[model samples]
Target: MKVTRYTKADAEQWDAFVRASKNGTFLLQRAYMDYHSDRFADHSLIFHDDKGHPVALLPANERDGVLQSHGGLTYGGIICDESMTTPRMLEVFDVLLEHLRTNGLNRLLYKTIPYIYHLNPAEEDRYALFRADARLYRRDVLSVICQDRRLPFQKRRARKVSQAQKLGLVIEASEDLEAFWAILEANLAAVHGVRPVHSVEEMRLLNSRFPDQIRLHVCKENGGIVAGVVVFNATRVAHVQYISSSERGREIGALDLLFATLIERDYADQAYFDFGISNEQEGKVMNVGLIEQKEGFGARAVTHDYYELSVV
Candidate 1:
């Protein structure tokens, strides 16, 4: 087997591998990667057999001596073909690590996907063999609303949705993202204790690159902004990319109302509603409960594979 850097010609194969793999994430999509490639200081690598058919893929972002498996990618690591035998996976990993070390990388972080929502068993086992020490991170709880709509509710979520509607909440989809970004950034710092993932330029670029895929859903009340959500309809799944609101939003159930409206309109036809992940490291308890709130709406939790590798 041989390992090499990815090229423009490999786009179709790369995406095909992702679509076929059980552990694939939206981040591995060609369009998503290309949309944010300019922000990262690295590239992607693929492993192939003598037949030259692609078998495994690793998209990493490198900076200085620290090498990460696609930093820009929410989930990263060696996503391999499920049919690959353990021996083949080990061999592929060996070559991949050797390449990284020889290239002056001090450490290799797999950023092992913690959720296996759809990973093939063989690919998951490959990750198991290489992981050294595992660090438990925040969980990205998912809900299959369409599959089991009668989920147990801890609070009156559905009723709240109705109340939000009664409270004169208006949901609008528009291209005016600058207003949303301002609210998002401020909310991120205040609530999550972090910065927004995308800059103004990056968001604009992505918005232009994926117009149909990206959408800004805002919930207004009393003729002003109360809450807003950035929803991405990448495939069959409708993911809540980002959500934010002001002080008044909490009082009037603006957020709950906004999400309810967005889900009804944007994700109404889809089967899955990805509420995004909660960062436990950031002391985000309210958000953690919010994930559970989604579960109340008949959402299920999906876990991914998280792996770590040491030089052998």
Candidate 2:
């Protein structure tokens, strides 16, 4: 087998391969890579068999000599066929590491495909790659939906939801990417004391690139957008990718009403709503609390694995 890098022209084949595989992530697609390639210098790599058919793919981004699974990507890496286990995965990783190292990259990080254990043979193959990369470790990605019977009825959850309704917040679908991003940035800083993962330009790029696949919703009161969410529609689920609100947003229950409205109107057909990840060690009681909140609305909890590797 031979390893080769991919070009923009290779997108269709890349996405086709990911869809054909059990453990494929949307981040591996060309559209995502191109949208965020500015953040990385080396964005694509593929493993091809003797007949030249691609067997494994590693979609990556490089920054300051460090290679990442993907920064703009929610998840990605050495996605391969189900039959290829440890030896095959090790071979591919061996090549990939060499390429990155030769290119002067120092570290590698990856968030493996979500729910790999629950997937089919193709998806299970990701575990093989994980096994080959000795430095990799698992981290928790918390999720909740309205269906989970085990979800607790936290007091804060009730208060927040009720407060949002009392504020008379109105939820509406919108295409105003700039406005949404501004709300996200402000919300993150005020609530979490941090910035969002994506910049306004990047958010706009993603929205413009996959307009149909993404939905932007804003919760308004008195002609102001108090909170907003960016939802991504995959094959079977709707992922709540980004959500943020101002100080007034929290007091007014803008978040609660916004999510409730989303669940009722836009994503009623989908089986689940993924609220994204939260760091478990940061005393993330709020994150856990959020899982419960979504559960009250008929969601359940699911965990995804996070992995890291050193190029040796």
Which candidate gets the maximum TM-score versus the true structure?
1
Regions of candidate 1 where Cα sits further than 4 Å from its true position? 7-26, 34-39, 80-87, 113-122, 125-152, 282-296
lDDT of 1: 0.69
Q: What's the lDDT for candidate 2?
A: 0.69
Q: Residue 115 error for model 2, in Å?
A: 1.6
Residues 208-291, candidate 1, lDDT per residue (tens digit)? 877887888888877777788877764456677788888887777787777666566657777566776653442234365766
- Model 1 residue 263 CA deviation in Å: 3.7
Candidate 2 regions exceeding 4 Å error are: 63-66, 80-108, 116-126, 146-168, 191-193, 280-301, 310-312
What would the per-residue lDDT of candidate 2 be over residues 1-312, giving only the tens digit for each residue?
Answer: 778778877878888988776566455567766775555686568888779999888777667767677666766656776656666776776777777778777677665666522235544435545565645466555565542232434466666777777766678988777877877776678767988777778777777877877778998888788888988876556788888777788777788778877776677676566776655552233465655555665555566655666665
Model 1 is weakest, by summed lDDT over 10 consecutive residues, at 132-141
Task: Report every candidate's CA lDDT.
Answer: 0.69, 0.69
